[model samples]
Target: MLTQDIRQSAPVTPTQAGTVATLMIEEETTISDAPLFVPEDIGAGLLLLGLLLSPKPPKER
Candidate 1:
């Protein structure tokens, strides 16, 4: 009886673990496909470029 219970429970744990892993993978993919992150990255790059190319103030002697 104990062996039968262990065998049954073993399958259940793996099935649940697989489901959780699949959900996590799907969520990660969804996050990666989000449109907001790309624009933010692009905006940051443009801002950095602008800052780098901007003229500096003349230093007072």
Candidate 2:
């Protein structure tokens, strides 16, 4: 899929903007088999971890 197509289809958040832009540019310019860890993955993972670890509010009586 084209970078523009991907960008249009995916929702871009403020935190993910940089990562998404970099990925889009790379996708548009190159075809490589390099093994890399994108910042977005780490950000998502951390967000998930934070959500999982946060305490839930007590139920109303």
Candidate No. with top TM-score: 2
Scored by CA lDDT, what does every candidate get?
A: 0.75, 0.81
Highest-scoring model, lDDT: 2
Which regions in candidate 1 have their CA more than 4 angstroms from the true location? 1-38
Residues 1-61, candidate 1, lDDT per residue (tens digit)?
4555443444458888999989877753334544555577589889999999999989999
Candidate 2 regions off by >4 Å? 1-41
Worst 10 residues of 1 by lDDT: 1-10
Query: Candidate 1 has which clashing residue pairs, if any?
Result: none
TM-score against native, each model: 0.32, 0.32
> Mind giving the per-residue lDDT tens digits that candidate 2 earns over 1-61?
5555443567768879988778877755567788888888689889999999999989999
Give per-model CA RMSD: 10.7, 23.0
